[model samples]
Target: TGVSKGAMLSHKNVVSNVLQASGAYSPTLDDGAEFVVTALPLYHIFALTVNCLLFLHKGSKNLLITNPRDIPAFVGELRKYPFTVLTG
Candidate 1:
């Protein structure tokens, strides 16, 4: 058995964070033409908000790495795409 604790965030919190990120990053339509490669797991808040949500908001493509430990495969996958941004 295990113990667990949970926290909840309202829609406004999410939207506010997204908006703040957009303002900070200043992503434009040109970003939509690029791709974002993320080694961090999307289950984590930072990756979820910045790598996935932020790019999605900018209309950019997201290439998620299911297993970043596989060095060869990871490099191969990155080479396969003209990735513009890499986040770990």
Candidate 2:
């Protein structure tokens, strides 16, 4: 949402804390879409809020990459999947 840590945290809590049951109803991940992640850690509030929570809620596969310095590799990874959304 916002650049400041406070704004980030605020949005994270409000956006990520979704209610979903854990059972066979567990949704599928990455049905078919464009989701690219470059150096975004799941632990971070930004990624956790937009990437982890939203994807899981929508049942999308999360291609977690800790290191995104290598642009070529990142592009390659991006090319491999059909993601609907690419987050930072």
Candidate 3:
């Protein structure tokens, strides 16, 4: 409901869910891959946790987006690499 660490905490929860979920719809993180988060790193939790921690565990690169709100800019940033995963 606010802009702070709570957002990061929530993102952490999402990462945990993805990692722990046994559902068939879930996709587990690969041992090695690159993840690019298009969501604002400072605006929400997904980038904070998943891009930071989970990728770290898998020895993946986390492309942190400082400003994800700008659509064109985001696309431009995305075109720079072949990202294995993009977390919103």
Report the C-alpha lDDT of model 1 over 1-88, residue by residue, as the tens digit: 6898666978888888987988888744355776899999887888988898888988899898899999999999988999888876
TM-scores of all models?
0.84, 0.56, 0.59
What are the candidates' C-alpha RMSDs? 2.8, 6.9, 4.9
- Measure candidate 1: CA RMSD: 2.8
Provide the lDDT at 5 for model 2: 59
Residue 87, candidate 1: alpha-carbon lDDT? 76
Sort the predicted structures by lDDT, highest score first: 1, 3, 2
Estimate candidate 2's alpha-carbon lDDT, on a 0 to 1 scale. 0.59
Who wins the lDDT comparison? 1
In model 1, what is the error at residue 61, expressed in angstroms?
0.7
Q: Compared with the true structure, what per-residue lDDT tens digits does model 2 show for residues 29-53?
A: 3433435453587777567655776
Please write out the lDDT profile of model 3 over residues 1-88, one tens digit for every residue: 6864432346556666656532422365566655645465543455544566556656777677777778798889888878877765
